[model samples]
Target: MLPQDLITEILLRLPVKSLLRFKCVSKQWLSLISDTHFRHHHRHASSGVILCRRTDIIHHVSLAGSNSDYQPFTSLCFIDDSAGVKILQSSHGLLLCCSNYKLGKARSYYICNPSTKKYSILPEPDYVSVSDNSSVYLVFNPTKSLHYRVACVRMCSSSFNSYQVEIYSSETRDWRSSGSPFAAPFDMVFDSGVLWNAAIHRISPTGASLCFDINQERLGAMPGLPSNEKWSRRRLRYFGESGGRLHLIEIYGCSTQFQVFEMDMDYSSWVPRYNVDIAPVVDTFPEMLRNCIVRNDFVLYAFSLLCLQEDEDDSLLLLHIPGQFVSYSLRNRTFKVLNSISTESNNAFQIGCFHAYQFMETLADADQYL
Candidate 1:
């Protein structure tokens, strides 16, 4: 028989799909794979991106190499048949989803691991009213703890400028209000909340960006890009966390050239990290260029930034063109097609818009929380 350490070393090198099947091989094998430490190490071995379509279908695209494949995964149909499920957020390996709002039925929220097909329906929050608009963000870091947390930000019923935050901890298996109601702009949107630096960071084009510290339970202002009259009419191209850093991408008008900013650790300012120009890509793939005349000025809406991968030698920017997924290297000004979309999905992608979530495969058990 192989030594225990040798067995674990071999198992850690295997992909998640094979490791999941090996879990049923023997009692001892199952114990080793289910170990928290082993699961944590295995999660870092592979990573991918989950693309959520407007119709609620999910497509998984691996990021393990420069050229990866895309496969149709699931629509989360098993959670609830009567209710339509939509993925709201993705933190680490877990996903935060909610049901469509029906006239008579209350909305249902769920945290699920699509890899393991394990899910838990969250209990209804106490502070939310029917009239209030609420957005829930997931905060889970297996490195910090095995437990996860869900933070809900809702507008106060009494004041338009006041917002309240509530947190649900899997360890406690219950919900609790975090801090007191705080003041924010009435038009601030919480839909783009990204978990980083132990807080949920949300950006707004018209107003000041905000961040809510999960540990301290306090709301504070997040630094925004430097002012520029040319970029006044801000179009948020991308705002997400990648490679353990918060990144923001905003475009002024119809230009393909832009700068990608990375937030400093102190949360004081944004540093210009990468300069991106997709004109070459548009020239190569003419189908991506969509030109329209607005007020006698030509406006071009060509591509969307799906994700930014930060690596020591091979930093990449993933993009969604008309009918394909492309990876553009930041270090070297070159691009390659990762995968292609079907005819039906290409048409849908053009009309409906782009929604992407980073997916990290893990063996973290969700049964304990349930």
Candidate 2:
């Protein structure tokens, strides 16, 4: 038998799937694999992407390997039989999901680690008003602490153009109100907040954005893109965090050529990182070109930026065309098909039909701090 320290070093290099199966070798191996420190080390060693379909099915896609298998998680059935559930956001290795609102049942929220097949139901927030709209985002950094937090942004019911923030801590296992109500644009939506730089960033449809610091419990305005007359009516193609960096892509006037900008650490300005022109990709896959007439002259194509992966050599951009996912290389300017969607289902796999979420496999326990 090998030394215990040597065994641990070898085990850390293994993938989460193999580590899970190796737990059955012996009780000692099981205990070692389940150790909090072991799991934290393993999490930093592996990373992947997960696509959340319109039907609420989560599919895992490997990032470093050629295996693009879709693993459906049927073990996520924790709520009542009648209520349906959908994922709201994903951070680190944890997922934030909520029960679909039904006529008689009160809505519930959940934080789960699908890799371990473990989940915990979160208690409802204190203020639940029928008239107010609320959005909850997941905040977790396994490297910092074992516990996670859920930040809720809800519109104030009594005051117009005012919003309140509430935080739920896994360590305390309870919800508490954060700072006082702050004013923001009435049309600013908080449903799609992205976690980056220890803060939750949200961009509104009208180009307004805000950032809420998790540690300081403060909200402030996020710097906008550089001003340009030509890009005045640009649409936000993508806004997400990848590899500890925040990226934003905006497309203007039905053009395939655009620039991907990376925000600075100080939130000062956005610097252009990648100049992408997917005209070749659209030409290769002609079916992806769905022309929409805008004001009878301009034409718009159908495509969605799924993910942006940063690496030392070449960064990759994941895009969704009607039924397929394509990977574009930023350095080489090459394109490859990552995965194809099946048309067997009733739902059409179009641009707006599905959403993508980054999934990193880890042994982070759902009930560790609870």
Task: State the lDDT of candidate 1 residue by residue for 1-370, as single tens digits.
Answer: 9999999999987766788899899999999998878987775445667777753566767643522552424567767636687888877788888877677877778888777777888877665542327878888888888898888888877887788888888998878889899887656778767888879887665747888898999888887565464435667778888778888888776677888888998988989988888888888887766533243243546577888877565777878866778888887778887766556666666532757777777777665675
| Each prediction's whole-model lDDT (CA) | 0.75, 0.76
Candidate 2 residue runs with Cα over 4 Å from true position: 44-46, 54-56, 63-65, 70-75, 78-81, 126-132, 229-232, 290-295, 341-348
RMSD of 1: 2.5
Residue 279 CA error for candidate 2 (Å)? 1.8
Q: Supply the TM-score for candidate 1.
A: 0.91
The lDDT, on a scale of 0 to 1, for candidate 1 is 0.75
- Taking all chains together, each candidate's TM-score versus the true structure is 0.91, 0.91
Q: Quote the lDDT for 51 in model 2.
A: 68
Q: lDDT tens string, model 2, 1-370?
A: 9999999999987766788899999999999998888887784444556766532455665554455553524235554335777788878788888877788777777788877777877777665632226888888888888788888888887888888888889989878888888987656777878889778888877777888887888987778775463444667878999879999998877688999998999898889988899999989888766544364345567778888878675688888776677888887888887655445431444576767777777678876766
TM-score of 2: 0.91
Runs in model 1 deviating more than 4 A are 54-56, 63-72, 126-132, 230-232, 290-298
